[model samples]
Target: QLMSVVAVGDQLVQQQHFGAERIQERLQDTLGNWNHLLDLAALRRKRLEEAVDFHQFFADADDVDIWMLDTLRLVSSEDVGRDEANVQSLLKKHKDATEELKNYASTIEALHTQAGQLGEQDRTAPEVVERLNSIDHRYQELLELAKLRKQRLLDALSLYKLFSEADGVEQWIGEKDRMLQTMVPAKDIEDVEIMKHRYDGFDKEMNANASRVAVVNQLARQLLHVEHPNCEQIVARQNQLNHEWAELREKAEGKREELNSAHGVQSFHIECRETISWIEDKKRILQSTDSLEMDLTGIMTLQRRLSGMERDLAAIQAKLDSLEAEADAIEAEHPEEAAVIRERITQITQIWEQLTQMLKERDSKLEEAGDLHRFLRDLDHFQAWLTKTQTDVASEDIPGSLADAERLLNQHQAIREEIDNYTDDYTKMMEYGENITAEPSTQQDPQYMFLRERLKALRDGWQELHQMWENRQQLLSQSLNLQMYNRDTRQAEVLLSQQEHVLSKDDAVMNLEQAENLIKRHEAFLTTMEANDDKINSVVQFAGRLCDEGHFAADKVSKKAENIADRRNANRERALQQMEKLKDQLLLHQFLQDCEELGEWVQEKKFIAQDETYRSAKTVHSKWTRHQAFEAEIASNKDRLVRVQQAGEELMKEKPELAELIAPKIKELQQQFQ
Candidate 1:
């Protein structure tokens, strides 16, 4: 039991030692873990210090450093796991260090934020002091600005109060000077100087206001003393002036309208002169009344002048009406002459309107005199133009050729346009003549008589030329037709000659049908030639001769064909008789020669009888003579012997007894032939 106890004690000691080693190992691991945590914290703090410029926040950086040292000491110490109290204390210290580090980091972040806000990498005391000094200086300046603003407000209020009343300007000036003197020492020199300038401006403004007030007072007094005109009296005077001016203006307007309506310059100028005189008289009277100084005598005098002008205007108008009526009578008597005279008068009137100012510059009274001179000049010019126009019309020639006609037509169109252009001018002149006070000279007034004569001549001449051209064209057409007819007739003649030559062949009978067709074609050409005989008589005659020749040739060829046919018939008849006789003789000779069967010799006899050489032998004697002459020819022929032998062989093959009976006879004949 003691040994066992001793063994247990040893086991307890070993177990205790093992537990101590394990505890040491565990403590070492905890220390390592803590060191690792410290390392992380150190790295974080270092990065924070570098990135955030932690030295700028010295307090926060120092606190973080102390926390780091405490953390390091706690982690490095060996008493961490000595007891529970020690362990608790170590944990508490670590926790406190962690908290301290967190707090330091927060403080550093806040300082960094502040540095960022200040736009500074290092928030040093010098920079802070400099900023504070700048703020202080700005505050001083603001305070000075506030004081100056307050003083300016006071001055403005004082000036406003002073200027409010008219009687306070002088007292305000005195007060402003005293206040400036008082402010010289207490205020900034600049503020004092500004106040002085404001004071001077206020003084000047007050002076100007005083002057304005004095002027206003003076104007007010003057207004009080001035009296307005009586409304009724002034209105009455204006109405009277208006009535008088209206009377004069109405007269002048009537005269102007009348003068404008007058076609003649003489009447127009006279009316214008009276109207202008009346207007001048009215203007003089109006000037007298413009100053409100018109009297009854002046008005009566104006009325008298106006009355005289009216009387004169009425007399002139009456004379103008009478002259116009007489001119109308004259125009009715000779309308064309009156028209020409009026045209001249209108031209003169136009010249008067254009040169009125120029003439007036030469002579004030030239309004009438110039119109007279212009009328005379235009009259002479118109007469000369009339003479020239008559001559031009008489000289106008008719167009000769087509091109000349076209040109003359264009010229005629141009002249018509010119006449149209003259219409307005001529009408205006006629109207002027109707309004003229005098009669115009009428030496020669041909009007458009010469133009009409020339137009008629041109028309007649053009008609004649057109007829000539038409005749020439017709002649040319006839000549062309004649030429075409001649060409066709010659072509028909050539065709007829060819047809005749074709008919002349020995086969005229065969070609007779074709020749008849050609005859029909030739007859058609002859018909065409006859139809156009008037155009091509020579060609038609030549074509007629060719047609006659073709007909005669065709008749001759037809008769020859008929005679040849008759001769052929006769010859055929005689050949048939001779053939018959030759056949009979052949049969008789064969019978006489004791050959009843002549076989192929009968066909040979028939063929020889129809031969051309014996064709003309119509008599039996002649045929016999021919046969006798051919007998010698038959005897010398080897072909005849071979033919006879072949015939005898065929006869033997066909009829052996008959052949045997004829063989002797054939042998005899063969012997005779040999």
Candidate 2:
């Protein structure tokens, strides 16, 4: 029983350890937190520029606030710093604490490792309290100093981005300007002058743009404080370092005040221990931070984003150049249209205002680019939008309307040439070949045939169309009426004096054939009033129906009725009195000899109203009557239209080559009011 009691006592002696081991564990834990401490500092530094009021934020970062909450980690249960109790009586009582703890832990670990070994019970624990107490002075000081240095190092690491190569941006800007100048021509005096002005503008713009990037970088840096090197030399030898510091601190604390060193030896011992402890601490820290150290994911993303941003900027610049070149080419081709182009240029000048505002918005968005990849993606989008906006204005375009106009002009010019040729031939005959002959030529000249063709065409237009109502429905009747009833027919004019015939012949060149060709061309040249004429009558009828149903005037009626009713109705009574002048027109018309009175007061007493210059009621009445007759004829013209259409088709085929050209002008005249 005594032997068993001794064995149990021996076991108790071998297994015992005190607070010294716990202190080392606590220190290791403190070092572990340091990894996150440095990371949080970095985050703060990165975000500070955009978060100038970060301190004002009431919600603290969850895991990230650890560094700023430093007091939570380093303070002990005694409401003092970890190393604050160096001079306490209980602390001093543990004189052998440091060495004993190390020896005890080693033995215990060996025991557990060799649990089945023979005679393991013979092993004894060291005097833990005395050894730990002995090393307390050195290890405590070392741990405290390491903590302070680590804090400072973390501060420096937080601000690494601020010390970028972009600090030399001004130098880069200067070089860029020099490159821009070199790219421009300097040989021509005006070019040199323009380049000089451009250089000045570039200088200012670069300064402004550069300053923006710099200010942001500077703001980011402002929140970072310099770091102290809390790191110790890392290696497997660090265990020895911790052991040595523990011994030194234990020895020195026995001989001096807790806060200050005595002899230089004490201070040296304190420092050595600290350096050694830091090395051990660093080894542990390296273990915890290895994952973070190996990871370059965030930084690499930032770099990639920045690269993308640069590419986007380059693309935008290329697109802008393309737009500018197209605009310049368009301007160069139409020098006579310079006024219109200048107006477009003025419109483009307003684009600068819009671009400036857009750039201001872009500047704001740039700050949101947290990493290089995000920045690049955003830049691409911005560039595409910019390109689209610029392309909308400066892109090359075909002026279809102008092309149509030019084609019409060419047709007119060709007709003018033909007319000029005909006139030239006439002038030649008049000037050189012959006197004005009273008889037809005996010679069968081809030129005369051509002249006769032109005269016949002219006669067709004047006689068939303008000679009285010669509707083709009654061709014989029309011909008789034109020949006999209408005194002004071209055929009748053929019976006039020889001079009259010559004059009429001259007027007969633009015949129905030419008019038909002109009409066809004009129809093609003019813009269609509607997509097709099929809906024209329907649209008009629908609009008229709406107007009639509503008792409301249409735009056409409103505009015309306002003019007539407002101008004429207000003067109705005065206008009736003004009709006394019309009697004068009747009086001046000695046309009807001895005209009766207009209202039959007395035929001879009326004295013919004596004013031929006055506005004539007969003219107005004749116009109204002619319009009514034409309307009536139009109302009864179904068969006449069919006959005229057949005749038109027949004549059109006779000159099919020029038929397309003449159809438009003929259609124009034919489609007009009588």
Candidate 3:
């Protein structure tokens, strides 16, 4: 529009209108000056905005540069720490500085952005790029220096941790070593056993300490590998710990050996004293002087006593031999006590020999007295004949057939008749013995009392023979009659024997499958036994009925029936017990299996719960989200854990024996869960 106006004005000027040329020239000049002033003002505003941007960049960069210098000084400090507490304090300060530096990351980023904008407006602004670069370089240096300082402080803290741990273990070692020095040598077997048991507990603790020390050493090695500042101190602490531990072990081992030796020596002394006391008792008995009897009975009694003493002496001799063997072992291990042990053994052997000699002399005196008595010769012959007759009576077995049983009965009758004939002879001998004892000279003699005793024994033996013959005759007759009635009794006996063998088996159940199989097998066997119940009952009833009918073998039949009934009842009870035991075992096995499965699931959850690798998330939000998910999983699974605990408690309430096995597992799981 202005150009159109200028063109119209020029045309008017050319037409020579009044003042057209002057107005056109003045409009051109005025338009030119207005355009120049507008351009100048626009130029001035652009320059002012650029100046603001540059000064803003400078202000931000200078602030960051000042921070870098201060942080550099802080990071560059050579002081690691004076001690653990000091190191921790310095570490905390370094951590705060590191966080402050991290906060500056955004400020530095904003500076880069502003510098980029400035560079884009004018590529020649090298100052902005150079200042930004300088600030970036200083920030990176601060980061590295801060990192180095933090690491140094951490290394110092780790070194102190080693010192603390090693000091604690060394203190424990010192206490234990003092305790070991106070442990006196045991005076007896029981004392030694107690001491050794306590020592074993210490040994276990020492083993655990060894592991702790190993961990300390391993940390020391790690620090050394990193070229820790206190290398010499770490080496010194490591060597001191290892050396103290070695010394403690040496002292413990020496005490163990000493206790063992003392135990062996004390055991030998106690056994030796007991043996000597026993020998003295035997000697007193041997040396006793009761009035001697010249009668045959007294001589025989003396001989029997001598024979028993000889047997006792033989047993004592065996004990001495064992003691000698033990002493040999003790001497081999502990030679210093060999003399005392040998002397005690020698004393025991001498006393034992003296007792043997005493026994021999007593035996010889009894033998000589026996030779002087004429009545002893006859009494010996009679006793020999009596023993033979008793053997014949006692040797009869149950007859297999009726004829054989009847024959045995007839033979028993003849033996009874012979015993009756001997009864008269026994009476005459007793009269003769009484008459000899009635003589005044014989009455005054110690042998007279022995004569009366001999007579009484002969009469008792004669009576015992009569009673034994009568019993044998009765048994033979019963056998003859029992042959016909033994079929039912024999069948029950055979069945009981078979069932006894079956019930005797005691196989152990090892697993759920085995327990179940055993229970099934037992149930089947019980079923079979149940089916045989009627057969067993019928046999008992039949025998009982025969007894009620006054059968010839009624007594024997009744006894046999009662025995069969008792055995059948016993076997039934046993079968029921076996089935119950198997079922219980199966229950136990199933419970253990369920517990094992639950334990494995709990263990899996524990492994996941104990994980500390959430730092894998690069951002705080990612880490927080992952942790929240983890917490949710734990909360969801809590009910499952509670169910496991409830199940364990219920199982313990139901089966008390399982409490011994499962309580510890439950408690451990509960602790880990907490």
lDDT of 2 by residue, 1-674 (tens): 64464455455555663554554455456556666788998877856632432322212222123322342233221321122232232233222333333353443343333322222222122332233333343335434544543443333333232223233443444555454536443334455445556555655665566454545345343442222232221111233333443443353333222112112222233333443343344234323432321112332333344444455446544544543454455456445544654554444445434543544544344444344334334333433533443333232332234344344345434433544454444344333223212236613555444434433444343233322222221333222222222222222223223222222231112333444444443344222322222233333344454345442234543343344333323333333333332322222222112111111322222233333433254688875775577456556653444444454455457536545544553364345312
The candidate, 1 or 2, that scores higher on lDDT is 1
Best by lDDT: 3
TM-score of 3: 0.49
Show where candidate 3 strays beyond 4 Å.
1-20, 77-100, 119-123, 150-154, 186-198, 217-236, 288-315, 322-343, 366-674
Residue 34, model 1, lDDT: 72
For 1-674, candidate 1 gives per-residue lDDT tens digits of 54464455556566786566655565557667778999999988866765555344444444544544554554444342333344445456555544544454454455446555432444555754454344334434433443443343333333222233323433444554454344332123344445445555644654565553454334333433442123343334334433543443354344333332332433333444454454345345434432321222233233334434445446544644554564565466446447654554354344334333332332332233444344433443444555454444343354444455555455544544554565565555544533442234321323233323433454354344435444443433333333443455555445444433533343221233444454455456445434543433344444344445453233433343344334434433543454343333333333333343343464475587678978777799988887887776665554655665665566567545455455676676565444
**What overall lDDT goes with each candidate model?**
0.45, 0.38, 0.79
Please report the TM-score between candidate 1 and the true structure.
0.16
Error of 2 at 438 (Å): 13
Number of backbone-clashing residue pairs for each candidate, in the order shown? 4, 48, 0
TM-score on alpha carbons, each prediction = 0.16, 0.17, 0.49
TM-score sort, best first: 3, 2, 1
